[model samples]
Target: MGTTSNSSLRSAGSITDVAGIEVGHFTDTRRPTGCSVVIVRDAAVAGVDVRGAAPGTRETDLLSPTNLVDRVHAVLLAGGSAWGLDAAGGVMRWLEAQGVGMEVGLAKLPLVPAAVLFDLFLGDSTIRPDAAAGYAACEAASVHAPAQGCVGAGAGAAIGKVFGIDRAMKGGIGTASVTVDGVTVGALVACNALGDVIDPDTGRVIAGSRTPDGKSLFDTRRSLLRGEAPKPLITGTNTTIGVVATDAVITKAQATRVATMSHDGLARSINPVHTMSDGDTMFALGTGKSGKTLGMMTLGTMAAEVTAMAVVRAIRAARGVTAGGLYLPAVSDL
Candidate 1:
């Protein structure tokens, strides 16, 4: 929704439309965990923001504007909590083989920043994503919209844990993109929140904790404000990670600002987000391949919108997960 000469309000439908971007997902259903790799054939300036108190991240320090690294080769979002961080190593291995990344004396160290969401509780906690899983994701990379919903890092994703796992809803990966005035902005999100997912346009709950009967929806915010019985919380079991890509030419600092503003999209679509137990993080990447037709302010605003839409898409596209006698239904199932 920026000032575009084209005046069209539609996108090419996925992040790949941004050009030079490829998305890949490697899902290990046996472990009920996987990783998603966002590959940029051409180096792209990157920035990140970690809002949650508990986060498992790798190579984030290098993303700083003051850091020597100006661009990133890929970003990995995976399941398996802290142990899943190993997946990043696999991505690095693949990139190095392809001759991508900052060149060192004898080797090119691929700069891949990664974040993990807790999904151990959803499947076999003992089986976690590892280096092999990361390499598989890179090998599976494609230029089209990656598979969404209960696949990739979202495989074990679950939402509305405020009332415990029994009442939680299925969470997964989703994507949305918009092209305006020849500038395209897109977002891909792995939604696994500790609160309810809302439809911002309608202001109605789409998914969240349910009553004991698993029939009526429970309002997590109202219950907290009313001082009802304290809901049990499983610390370090939730988080949401995502990426925002644009063709606009922007600096690392500006990319950081875009990441900051994009959090507004999470707030708009999720109630009671960024809690202590969640490790919510987002990354902003700029390809700088297109002319700067829109101001930074306009691009930032549109990024937020794209992110919010991606959140809604995540919930809508999610598929039910059932393993070890635990059943979590996607929004459509309900």
Candidate 2:
């Protein structure tokens, strides 16, 4: 197998191999909500898949097998609980103004794919990232690496909630990339797992459940074995969404396979993932830049490894904050 480890490439910025893809965020710290936009190459081939039992997806039809041949211009990741779906409307408006969508007769429509995760339960339900925020995020996109952690869609993200906010830890967005046979495959994830994040290689808990006293969160297996029912709390509404971008040419089917492989990264970095509480999802985009040829399965596996690394980075980049006299650790401290 090709080497999947990326410990040697440590820098506080986006991966260098995945070129032409830009990221931007519009955050609302006062309200604990925000949105992000990931702009692939001006026109790239893209595909998507949603495996979570409960997911909030938008513009999925654009990734259908028939739609795969067309070029995908952009993707939007937003916050507002389920209500955040409106953010896409703003993106559409901007794209339409730029003539970035599908063509119909004499008119050119913008084809922007988007996805969303829930964050309303974190703060004031009344406040959310509106259409204006979506436009702002898109306007901020550039070639440089974008900010991570409690910025963008991850602004209100939290984890380790089998016992509510008392045990939840700070979670946010992260990214990683790798070169395979001269082809670059990169991944970015917004982590909000129900369980804690573990460093699989070291057997250490990097992030996850926390104590009310602001200490490391630990396994609660012993408490469960005692025949006590798990805490009946509203802590299961979490999800992790990501995108896998590659320069290699691939079909929609291949893109879907890459997405499935990316989930492997999630399983490695997060404990008890794909659970009813977590709505984990992944997307794949082909930039059509690399000339190398490879099997779909091979790319899938590599995508998974990169995805896992990105998720860990997201956790490690979080920043701890205090709320209601309680201190919450951010990914940066992990």
Candidate 3:
């Protein structure tokens, strides 16, 4: 197993000691355009758990612990609304060619897991990633690790606005890692939170709802208490999704536990998370090389921290976009 000293670990930028995990993205900048693919680790044991009431998810059934496929070669996070789910077919095709899939009598079946978020981009409806785009993403996965912020699933992602887009903030993909006793666990998130992204340690809003002048994003609770009419606008059509990868030896069941625990990190970093307007989902992947021993609950707690850190990283790495005469800047850009 790869190891790094605890004393040398850092939280800013990319954390140290996170090994074997690789990320890749394919982005289309056209209107209703977005990004795809966030491979956590090569040949990873993976699982998923969803906690949103109005989630628009796909491939969740494959995460079951009893599934014959014990490992997932890649995960695709893309923007194309529900229609974009078709992108996974391309990934499946690629994996089939690589001989990475479930083996039957005569042929191998690909077991690529995928998830998506709706970025309709003001109802341009025609916009979304297709099978070709998915293939492009798979091709891109062959290169260096992914680039965060305003890319991939986050390309058209925005946050805030229980009110309207005027208060939405730019949110994208962010990553962070931590090491404990020589074991490294890292997280990457595609943040599209309904609530503002906050620094858990400081309780300060780093991103989320913001005024046109680039002021504080509105608080949903405060707005409700003020008797403001609830805007059912498509403003909060967001979903934050990503993976937690570690070198630790973990089973699919344990990975499921890690995915469940990671939600706490979302709750910590984003206010009023797991809301109806948000299709929040998380995945966990174990690379099966870190010979560290950890209790299920302890690993869960670590997952939460790493998840929160990844959310913050995504917010901080975001960039501004001009939409509807409004300048929506990323959390860090502001």
Candidate 4:
């Protein structure tokens, strides 16, 4: 929470509260695999941070402050492991159809940076998200908060993978927003981690690895410290990807800083986050629509808080699923 003249928080409760932001999702009904799009149609300056060692990303180098691209049309988060990166092409096509992008020579290139999380373990791996799924997500874009949990990029996400899928619980997308001093800071997260999900406010395990009976949480961190053996990890099996946005005016470097600091949110919510098998990535966007500003410290701090809120929301909102004889329980189920 930043010191705002108004001192009251606006309650849209999603990242869309940030001006010029829209969210859309495309979920494959056959299985929990799909993508979500965050459209910054007004050309928001963007930056990114990749903390997980096994990441699947596209166009991220261009988002660096040193790069030529100053802004991005959209950020795509998808479920399908590395294959999901193809969804970015669909987003590009959708944006090009609407004539959105940077004009270089005779071509308008819609800059869309994307990240993918592994959900291939669920159901049919071959039926992953594709370009059509990406375009369909953009087609469903809306100014509303968009559906959360068990949808879009979060569809196939799961946590507690440190003990394998049998002990894992469902993870999904969540979002939240806070207005500070007339500037709105919002976060959207698709949380699929290789650890337990904790409640930042309560400092307690909310979801994640479960006991053998599947009736209680194992508290993964404590278990590991107490000598419980974690299953062998396959690279790229887990990841948490998302975006943080604000209406405050900020430079590309500052945006990058925000993205970096926002990782604290994941640290707060996920025990043992940013592991080798996970590919955690976050992007920061500045729409500058509020015509307002906050100090880098305050803005970055607020982004982290909002991001944590979104992560917790993701766990709380997730729904249990049973498909193909595989049952992945959600918070509600336990």
Candidate 5:
């Protein structure tokens, strides 16, 4: 396994701060579609939590504690609706090419669990993420903090779609890490929600649906409560996906608990999440390199804290965009 440099990476407070982990992105220039990869070349114990009713996922069942496969090579978050799940194949292929994977007779099958968000509506829907794009993301893998904001799977991400996309704001990728007693826990999130992105610290809407004039933030939760914006739900059209990694050793079941608790961060950051229309998914990876000890309660709480921080970073780092008479603004614009 190749080791990555944390000397500079830690300064950026990125997920790469977790030892032996690398992050990469591949954004399609022709359209706002791409994939992000978290390469754990040495493999790590992994767990996942699918909290939404409509999810576009791959290999989540294998992450169960009872399952035989516990070591994971990489995790992929992408944009393209269900079709985007195909990109995971490319990740697996790349790992196999590098002689990485579980030995199965003469072949080594890489275990790559993935999740996808809906960005197909952002550009030409015909052009979605493919195998080549995933491979490119692998090629771009770096131990340094990756370029966040409007890139990778978050390039075309939109949030606060309670009134559909016309009033939605730009959503993107962000990362943050926290160190506790020598154990480091980090998070990377691609935010594309059906509700507003709020700053949990202040309880203010950050990047979210704008008013009809598209000038000010329209708190989605408030709108729904006041019966202002009510529309039929569009299943499988929205999602927020991310990964939380730690250097502490943990069992697969413990990792699953970490992932589940991370949702507290999502709930705090987003006004309304895990709706029938949203496919919110979270993954937790334990690299077990720190040789540090922490109780499950402490670890899970820190997971949620970092996850929320990353969500705020995604909106703050995001850049606005305008296309086809639709204007999606970032937090800066608000």
Candidate 6:
């Protein structure tokens, strides 16, 4: 990647910093589960990687390089596990109303791919994201920088579940951007992990499992060193879903590679990530606005780097939430 000053990177702001993208979220704070949508005002070449063993995804197969649909109109990340997939319907409706989609003989089909994280247990599972919520988010879509932490799909997100819900910390959405040689890459993450959250720059646990009394730190990596199984007071309730976008022109295959590489950020920040119980997934989008100022390899590398930054930012920006009789601490508490 071409050299970019730290100040420039810091000033790049959220994923919307990439031209032609609009983001919005519809949250039900009372239920603590919601949905987020990234509306590509201009359709973008997209690719995805689903690393977690139990992922709840929609239309991901169509994103393959060999597939017919090379560009996507929107990508959604939401809470409520598989049930949240319904939110995509609302996105489709919104796009269709705007007359943005693939042309068929009589009508247009909006291409929207979505991923869902398990947040049902965090609040009232009965109240989950639906088509109404999705449409609401789209109506609220704007190029304005997105709000991070404890918002959108991450409203009920939590991390460091290796010890259990009681010890887990709160996690939410975060965004970061870096511009190199005119090419801008940005990332947005909803971090609800099965492992501890570490600040990659500091190599320290910033927010994660804590002692029962909530006075001391608990490192999940150390527990794994002993090769012991963890008995989570709550199980099968975590995932980290995110999007990485760039203005550089790149092919769908290259975007797929970028998506694969972006997972490095998750590995760096989340210990024991992509676990069987988690549904970790990422999407890469190339808007082709800046030509090819950055090489594919360099762009992919920066995608990973910014992804890590976004992860730390998510933890730092997150605020704690108490639901279902459990208290999840935020990074500020640490």
State which candidate has the highest TM-score.
Answer: 4
> What's the TM-score of each model vs. the native?
0.95, 0.88, 0.88, 0.97, 0.95, 0.95
State the weakest 10-residue window (summed lDDT) of model 2.
1-10
User: What are the per-residue Cα lDDT tens digits for candidate 1 across 9-53?
Assistant: 334377777777888898996856888989886778999999988
lDDT of 6 by residue, 1-334 (tens): 3236644444437788888788999998577888999989679999999999888899999989998889999999999888999999999999999998888879988999999988876767888999988998899899898898888888878888887778788889888888887888888899989889888878888888787688767788887687856874434578999999998888999889999999999999998898988889999999988776677777877898888888888888888788888788787876
Q: Residue 132: error of model 3 in Å?
A: 1.6
**128 Cα displacement, candidate 6 (Å):** 0.7
lDDT of every predicted structure (CA atoms)? 0.85, 0.72, 0.72, 0.91, 0.88, 0.86
Scored by lDDT, model 1 comes in at: 0.85
Worst lDDT run of 10 residues, candidate 4, spans 1-10
lDDT of 3 by residue, 22-140 (tens): 56566775653465665433577888988765576666787889886668777777787677778888877777777776667698766667777767653355868888788787777
Better of 1 and 3 by TM-score: 1
Best by lDDT: 4
- Of 2 and 4, the candidate ranking higher by TM-score: 4
Residue 302 deviation, candidate 2, in Å? 2.1
Candidate number that wins on TM-score, 3 or 6: 6
Question: Can you write out model 4's per-residue Cα lDDT over 6-66, one digit (the tens) per residue?
Answer: 4444343789888899999999999988999999877999999999999999989998899
> For each candidate, how many residue pairs have backbone atoms clashing (under 3 Å)?
0, 14, 5, 0, 0, 0
**TM-score of structure candidate 2:** 0.88
Better of 3 and 4 by lDDT: 4
TM-score of decoy 5? 0.95
lDDT value, residue 65 of candidate 6 = 94
Task: Count steric clashes of candidate 5.
Answer: 0
